[model samples]
Target: MSQNIFIIVCIIFVGLLIIAEYRAAKRLDSGFLKWVAKPAASLAFVLVALTGGALDTTYGCWILIGLVFCLLGDVFLIPTGARTFLAGMGAFAIGHLAYVGAFLSTGPEISGLFLIGSAGMAGFAILALRWLWPNLAEFKWPVTVYSAIIAIMVATSFLAAPGQSSAPNWVVIAGALGFAISDIAVSRDKFITHQFFNKSWGLPLYFGAQLLLASSV
Candidate 1:
């Protein structure tokens, strides 16, 4: 369909942009391209959700709005400065809340799954601290907290009704883990230590998480 092609095009464009960013070393465009592409991607998600066999088109459109906020948040993160960075994180937190709202639209079948995912998120937090704390040093708490939130949010998706059982659980799982990993690396790179490297890894992992999150819906 046209919408599917649009999504495909957005993905290809983002991938190419990332490659261009990497080759350019310091990023030449000020991330305006990130701005344009994300909304396109978000719109494509809504189109797919509405016309691609969803039961509730209205609900799907609203959920897609949450996705739009996330894309906007990514746009805000472009400056590589502290305020924009934190704002980006806040925007994503809101997006997660929107996702939570969407999941809740399915009712309480997911409560048990949510609890399980919460425990897993906590366990991951403890494990992350034990594993990365010493190496991370200064920014440990921030990264850990961010990852904890994401783990819970991502896992919470499983709480939604299996109406869309066609959704790929692995993509969701990868997205969850990707956010945790990339954010940890980002915190280290920005706040704690310079020992960690890999913009390539960070870019793909974080954006891939978003890409997968959008697709899983």
Candidate 2:
């Protein structure tokens, strides 16, 4: 009961923080408030996982680690600059690897679901790169590699056992999709256009994804 309450509170807090950050971002303000609120939102999801007893299993621990890296990515992206941007990308890449580890913890299996999902994600990655490549400049290869890594992370979720209702694979898949959408929004805003409106879509997708993953544990 206590754990449930904590998770609820965290969810509420994440909602509020995401809204706050969205509003602040629209004002072109990556101010102290947004910086603080953005990370707080991620922390809330991490707390949800921890409080929900994700620490009880090895897979859960890997999930927690992935969330932590995402938190780090969030913080690293707060500042405006290429160095920090790359840092954030590196962090998120590692986070995706951690997620891949968590998904594989259950054991490996080759299934139609995995193949289909991987192919779809690969197609999306190609399209996204096709659009983003010209603008990627010196970051082209880095972005390509990271995109492939994240696609693999999403594909790995389909490898989870399918027979159980509480298997958490579906939730993981939803979260991975959310994460991918959020990143697309971010890339568009950062490289294709400069606008806070992107945050309107990005922040919610990101927080929602993290929360979904948290609940999976």
TM-score of each: 0.70, 0.89
Q: 153-211 in candidate 2: lDDT tens per residue? A: 99888875422443447878898889988999889988899766777778778888988
Local distance difference test, per candidate? 0.60, 0.81
Where is model 1 more than 4 Å wrong at Cα?
Answer: 24-59, 110-115, 127-145, 162-182, 192-197
**What residue runs in model 2 are displaced by over 4 Å at the alpha carbon?**
1-30, 162-168
lDDT of 1 by residue, 155-177 (tens): 76666543456342555556556
lDDT of 1 at 156: 66
